[model samples]
Target: MDTPLKNLAIIGAGAMGSGIAALFASKGLNIVLIDPMEGALERALKTIDRQLNVYAPGGVQEAMQRIQVSPGLEAACNSDLVIEAVPENLELKRGIFAKLDSLCPARTLFATNTSGLSINAIASAVVRRDRFVGTHFFTPADVIPLVEVVRNDDTSEDTVARVMATLRFAGKRPVLVRQDIPGFIANRIQHALAREAISLLEKGVASAEDIDEVVKWSLGIRLALSGPLEQRDMNGIDVHYAIASYLYKDLENRTEPSELLKSKVESGQIGAKNGQGFYTWSPERRERVLREKSAALGELAAWLNGKAGGS
Candidate 1:
């Protein structure tokens, strides 16, 4: 099984791809960043360097040397680990995995930097489903501390443990999720909140600004400390359960599945991912969002470390 990463490959040099590449390279690991074109890889390198410059302690320049930008897939095949950060399309991701499956050695760990997808389906194109795991990193991966290590039903204990160890070795909070589900872990909660957030906006219940304020400073803040389940237990499940029961019949039940969301997919408006959502984005705006999030994550990581007091 793949152990703590000695060398890593990041496929699809876009925002997430570059961020993941910067993450490993910043931690002193050799990273090969590959893209279908030289321009994509070049843009990814610029973004990665900018992020590392912001949060990277030694400045981005020093760490750029460890990052090998490759326009060719052949160079990436040498990695001990390959993280596919391609587009969210299943076929595209699976196609990349199939090539990686054939390009790399049997022992190399295969990971998808996907937020919400079926690992089994992705790995179906490859022979080793056990080695295939979800290594979901945040947008600015170099700075985010949380890395959800999702293990599917077919996954072995050793595979899960080794991936967890690798992330931990890179100073991440590698949270193990035993089951594979759509939007696993944080993203599930995010989608739940987002779905409702969209509902509130469409239903004229509140303005977008007000809704964000209420959640960001209230439920969103509290959720940072503990999840909904733990928070309910802390407050009282009976009371929480009662609230959910009422919500299911009232405000929550009143919510219609977003036509905008559906049409967006049909029309291809995949948020900042595709440059449109509830908000619109440009290349400049995308980088701005990433930079802001990365800085926040770096601060959060530092605070978490201090809170743990070096354990």
Candidate 2:
């Protein structure tokens, strides 16, 4: 039997890394959060404190105490599991893993929080390929419940099982990907929807506001309760099949990104960061929306947990 996970480490003190650390620490795991960049660790601690206040108010002090900030990978040499949550750069991640492979023991399992990078490619940097897996956590990791535990060709069943168990212990719902596909599961579907949404917007079929409203009021509510496949079953697979038979051809099938998105990037209208994209977001609006969204997500997560417990 595999040893139980206790000591965890997260490389990078960015938003995702800090969130992941806070999440595990809340569950009583000792986390060593490492970031070499000056002030990054401090920022991460503040972020983690805010998150723990929201997620584990009664135990904020205990949870905060569980996380130890560090400036180098050496501090994480003793960790049972080390998760790389750095930026989505293949070469950078590979270098980090190579260093970790040299410092850590053979028993230490490695995981990457890469959104869609090839698991096999990332694992190639280390000799313990069988112990490497992908633990793709969505943005706001502390709130999101779904985590894709991706298995590359070299990843062992034991590695996958242990990672899944660890994520479950931290209050996350882990799904085994089995295959190392680009974008994993949720991201691929999300991009497909974006393609269609952008295509419709470009064609003047509907205004951006209305298109977003339709998805928010309809699919958003429905998807929270039932996934796409389950909803298709509920609606009679034949009906969905019939719709797809015709609608499939009409849907966007562009192999590349939509021209509208490309043009926007060229024009420096890269959404919230720039104050404009599909919609204009002033600094105040961006701040307010993020704060509101975080609060709402926390409430929703609590409600979902309650529902899951009752069921």
* Candidate achieving the largest TM-score: 2
What candidate 2 gets wrong by more than 4 Å, as runs, is 1-4, 308-311
lDDT of 1 by residue, 113-198 (tens): 88889988888888888888998988567776788988766777877887887788788888888788888989877777788788
TM-score computed on alpha carbons, candidate 2:
0.95
lDDT per residue for candidate 2 within 1-311, as digits (tens), equals 33449999999999899989999999999999999998999999998898788768999999999999899899889999999999999999999999999999998999999999999999999999999999999878988888999988999988888988888888788999989999999999999999999999999999999999999999988788778998999999999989999999998999988889899999999998779989999999997887679879878877977986712
Instruction: Report the number of clashing residue pairs per model.
Output: 0, 0
Give candidate 1's TM-score. 0.88
Q: In model 1, how large is the Cα lDDT of residue 251?
A: 52
lDDT on C-alpha atoms for all candidate structures:
0.80, 0.91
- Number of the top candidate by lDDT? 2
lDDT of 1 at 109: 83
